[model samples]
Target: MMFDAWLTFAVIAGAVYLFVTEKLPIEVVALLVLASLLALRLVSTEEALSGFSSPATITVAAMFVLSAGLQRGGSLYRLGELLAQIRRGWLLALAMMLLTALVSGFINNTAAVAVFLPLVIAATVANRQPPSKYLIALSYAGQFGGVCTLIGTSTNLLVDSLARQSGEAGFTLFEFAPMGVIFVAVGVAYMMVARRFLLPDLGIPEQSDTGHAGRYVVELLVGEKSPAIGRRGSELLPDDAGDVVMLEIFRAKQPVSSPRGEQVQAGDRLLMRGEWRDIEQARKKLRLDYDHVARDLDGDVAAERLHAEAMVAPGSHLIGHTLAEVRFGHTYRVRVQGLHRHRLAIRQPLDRVPLAVGDVLLLDAPEKSLAAMRSDPGLLVLGERVQERTKLGRALLAIGVMTGVVTVAALGWLPIVAAAIFGCIALVMLNVLKTEDAYRAIDWRVIMLLAGVLPMGIALQNSGAAAWIAGIAVDLVGGYGPVVALLTIYLLTTILTEVMSNNASAALVVPIAIATAETLGLDSKPFLVAVAFAASTSFLTPIGYQTNTMVYTAGGYRFTDFVKVGLPLNAIFLVMAGLLIPRYFPFS
Candidate 1:
């Protein structure tokens, strides 16, 4: 290998290792890879940053904004709520599968999944079923739906860009629909079966008892001058307490579990579990305040205010801080009642647990503070809607804009990228979503990841690394004939996708697929189509695709669940793609 090829392989190997271990957020890892390439002089700064301006990146970002507008307008929620009325589990699952896939075919799958997420969660809550059963299906549906159209996923667009870059015609809108629809049909059938046997029914979430606001356990200290010093614990708080339950009382450092009628004393510690509103009321009644927070639960709970669930958003600066270090109470004006990490809930003495990207916080904050937290991109309020209901006029306008964008692109009046950008502008002008929120709606993490990884692909192609890899693949599989060579490319792309960003996978593997086809003296379009379809079929891992990651925490699923359900589905897809790609594109 040449110097450039060696450098490219080294970077790829490092990136793959980092992605697998997840020591750093994938976006950060991607940026690091980009910076390394720049430092190595493998590519110019322009090439390194070209992905930011790439149509695939812009289209994905615009789609996010557009989806945010629709979500903000309450159109998606309304549909979700309607779907929540379905009592039969199988029917509901089918509806979600079909709806998510259908919408994803037109819009970005991440946005489609996000819009539908709350609905599935709410429906699961109402049905007293575990969200785990349905969320994976939703993620899978998004992938299937995304494959149905050119704009359905950034992966497809990335492949299209690669094709054009490689001197081939780009895919027109709906060009993949025929094959994509078949794959979607197969996916839907597979998911329906998985719903019955593969998925787990987790029952009601532990926090469900606290109602839609979520539950939190907090400790409060009684001041010497507090009004409730002589009062019984039950009487000191509200009669209903809004699902708040006093779990324990510590008098003179002695533990008392379920102390309902215990009299309060100055400096006495009380452990409580309840909703944010209830916690706030109890704190006020006890004269507890944020400034008076005890050093530990044994000391006091004065500084903590309310109880609710807050998820660390992707790209949040808050990712690696412990509650005490962050001055979390003072900083966010809320106290964390519990920590839910990796689907496991940890309660009490939460001072040292470091927050991660997907860790959900059971927080206690005042109503005003909680409202403020809602707008903070660093934290996401869960199990409730803090924003106002979407206006019907604005929602209708958003729907119209989305339809217009799709129409123009489908008709070739404007490219998907331009149409999507115009639609974003329309959303803001029509008051469907605010300009600031529109920008915020775009997940910069994803944007930067795509931007950073695109250049890596350029580097690979420029360094002859892509062709070298493709030639080797062809040599290894060419003896097996063209059909097997096609299957090998499709399978390789699918595997790579599960371990990396779909766009990056498509970018890296498409060149190899093209080279392999050329080596076999066959039309490359079949191989290209196979790679495109394969790249979008990321079912084996939660981190494989954007939509899967979105649902991972929301559904409270383990990584193994994806593997369990996705493995079979992936095999089925591999077979389906191998059989169908040549029929559609023709290897001869």
Candidate 2:
């Protein structure tokens, strides 16, 4: 028993290290923990593989699909339209945080944050305030609301699932809200108070979007004697016409979206937009025989109508591919005009820069093609999603289905797992999310991580490691009181969460929390509650939460920015949890 206990301790420590280092995919590390626990004979094979079929894992996956359906329904986007009307930057910022928290409590917080990301950016641009001021607050708001409901965040469900496995009654949907609301209130108030002094205004400027006042559309034919015939389309604009945008090329009356990798040929008419002087200068620079069929040419002003923006979807196949390599123009039927990464506008050739998940591309495609762009999962077009009458109807239905799922589960008409599963089937039949989109909506990495880590909790308990650790923790803190023991659990969970995946942190700490409660002769619910709140509220670092990581580059924030902004929020959460956790979930 002692050997097994020590071995369990070693495996868990190694797993924690791997999670912190992130040298392997988090899911892979989870699988390793399961494998090690079993191979070391710490857990039976059934126990080792049980997380895959665990209720927590399945519900997490189902919630992901449910969240996708609601997101597709355009409800959040509609809400954003209302928020946009608040012109005062500070209030607008506060409102954004509030809405994010509210929406997140019902669905996946990451999805909630994602839906609001572009809206926040647009609102900031309109108000002429830096997005960085509210982006972190927006991320923190997701956590705030996430803890309010059972289904709000996967971490909540995960801890609930673990608690249920220990023979405790499953938590109701709103069980966490009493304390969660306190946390949100405190966090939001902190944001409002600290906004001016702490929130950094270092967002990346749109350097690619220079002056537009003097530019006009013009078409130039690559004449037979033109030096541009054999070169790439981008090279056609000489230094004098550097601001000119090559929108398209027509050869034999066929349109190409800027000849990405193809050589320009004579008689290929280049569709471009720039200042008339630059246009006239480009015409002279091109050496085209303008006295012939092209002499009576007059330019049209149409480029602005064709330009749009799209972001590379997270986990997109296009993340590492350059524009030329992906044949981006041909594949997506859109011309790549420029790219923004993190906060820096790439002034280099677009052909060489590799795409990343958050990369925002300035594209020139026809209106019809822009509509088609939304169909590809690899890219998310940034702006207000279409609210066409048909889409709005589907969105409404999607909203209804999601509400039913939450209602039935909350009222005990069905287990959350069952209600959620039925809700997903209804969503498909109702066509809110297409079959493929439903699959895409599930962040399988998280599902796999849950499946992979729950078993570690099982192993920890089976090997007597939990009791040993719990005894030590209680011995150190028990002299103070049960409240102090609760605080110890909360603080340790909080520390682990700041360094590793929150789900994993919750999984590892829950069994220890149960053991600690037993050692102290108290109810485990408060300890469990401490674990849930602590694991979910990671604000100390960008990597501590996925939402924070998403907005890191977009907001153009520094590493210390998270520390500077998140420290106070973390303090607020700690204080709130310490006071209210025992109050709501008494330590009897």
Candidate 3:
């Protein structure tokens, strides 16, 4: 028993360390933990594999499919367009955050951010403000909004699932809403205040010109018998050149997206855009002749090619793959000239930089193909193409399915697992989402993490480690009563969540919280809710929540930015949870 206790503690400690450092993927670490526990006989195979069949894991997986269905239906795009129309400023920031929170309450927070990201960029540009002011708020709103519903995040579901496994009633669909509403209100107010003082103004120069004046769009002609002839378009540019992006290539009088693998020919007309200084330097660096008359020749030339701006969609196939690897140019018949992510310009080796979901690409393609571009579903064409088509019928059906899931689950007509799984099947059956896409929609890493860590919790219980720790914790704070013990659970969970994944934190601490409450001869509801809330309130750092990390790079924010803005909010949550949990979930 002693050896088992020490081994369990060491495994948990190592898991925490790996989660913090993130040397490997979180799922990999989770699997490692599961494998170690099984190999060491700490947990049997049946116990270790139980999480895969757990209601929480299934529900979370189903939610991902539901979220993906919504995304594919183009509902999120419409929301973004509506938000972009709002007048830009503090009011806009507040509204964006509120709307983001509201939408995220039902759907995945990451999807909310992914859908609204480009819209926020447009809002900032229209408002003539740096994205730094609003992007972090967007991230925070998603986090805060997630706490509003049991399905708002995987953390709540995990806690509720564990509670049920411990023989307590699971959370109702709206059970989290009352306290969650307060958290969202406080978080929004704090972020609005932070925007004025704490957020940095990342240098995004205001657009003074009406028609791409600050940017240079130059047409370069490949010289006959030149050194660049017969090489791929991507090979023509220097590997380190970050200055120029290829917008369009009039090859044999045709235009395409990314010319990554296309062999460059003499007399090929390349239309590129970048900073004038960078372009000028790049022009000299790459042997090319300027096409002065090509600008005028456009009047006489066939209308086969055109230049446009496109925002990479959230679930784009292009994401995480390099242009060259994806044959981006060949596939789309488009030449990518410039790229922007999170409202900031990206520097070269454009072909090598893996594309992210929200990146905005400047592409040159055939004018006729622009209409067909909507078929890609991965790239959302901005401006004129904003009215791109979607299957409204399918989208409406998807929304109805999600609503039905909530209604059934809320009414207790079915368990959340049953409702959610049914919703997923409906999505696939009604053709709202493809079966393959449904599978892709589920984040396997999260599944693995939950499946792996659940056994550790079981081991803790079976080995009496949880009760042992609970006894120590309660004894240390029992003299102060249940309030202190509850707060300790909340605070510790919150701190751990800041450094590791929230789902992991909940899995580790929820059992301890339950044991602590039982040891005190108190109802465990308040303590359990405290763990759920604390695990979800990871505001102090970007690494705490997936949505926070989504915006960190896109917003061009430093680690301290989250601290500077989210620290106060964390404190506010701490006080609120401490006060409200006991009221709503008494410790009798």
- lDDT against the true structure, per candidate, is 0.77, 0.78, 0.78
Tell me model 1's lDDT, rounded to 2 decimals.
0.77
For all predictions, the C-alpha RMSD in Å is: 7.7, 8.4, 7.6
Q: Give the Cα RMSD of candidate 1.
A: 7.7
Q: Which tens-of-lDDT digit does each residue in 128-184 have in candidate 2?
A: 677778788888999999999999888999999998988876689888887788788
Please provide, for model 1 over 1-588, each residue's C-alpha lDDT reduced to its tens digit, 9 standing for 90 to 100.
488999999998998888767778778888898899899988899988888888888888998888878877877767777787898888999999998888888876776776677667767777777778888999899899998998888788888877776777788889999999999898999898997798876557544343332355566777778887887877767665677777667776666554667777788777676655677776776686442454443223454444567777655557667788888877766656555555334444456556776667776566677787765656667665445455788789989999999899999999989999999999988877888888878878778878878777777878888888878887788898888988898888888888877767777788777777777788888888888888888999888886777677766677888999999999998888778887888877
Model 3, residue 96: distance off in Å is: 1.3
Query: How many angstroms is residue 353 displaced in model 2 relative to the true structure, after the best TM-score fit?
Result: 9.3
Q: Model 2 — TM-score against the truth?
A: 0.79
lDDT of 3 by residue, 1-588 (tens): 868988999999999999998767788888898899998899889988888998888888899899988888877777777888888588889889999999888888877886787578667777677777888899888888888899998888899888887787678889888888988898888888889999988755344321221344556778875676787777777766566677666676666556767777888877666655566567776677754332432333556666676656544567668877987766666666655554234333456667765565666677655677755556666433444345789879988999999999889999888999999999999998899889877777688888888887887877778899999998799999888899999999999999998888898998898899889999988988998888877888877886676566556577888898888888888899888888877788
TM-score of candidate 3 to 2 decimals: 0.78
What TM-score, over all chains together, does every model reach? Answer: 0.80, 0.79, 0.78
Best by TM-score: 1
Model 1 bad stretches (over 4 Å) = 210-307, 313-333, 343-355, 365-380, 384-388
| Candidate no. 1 TM-score | 0.80
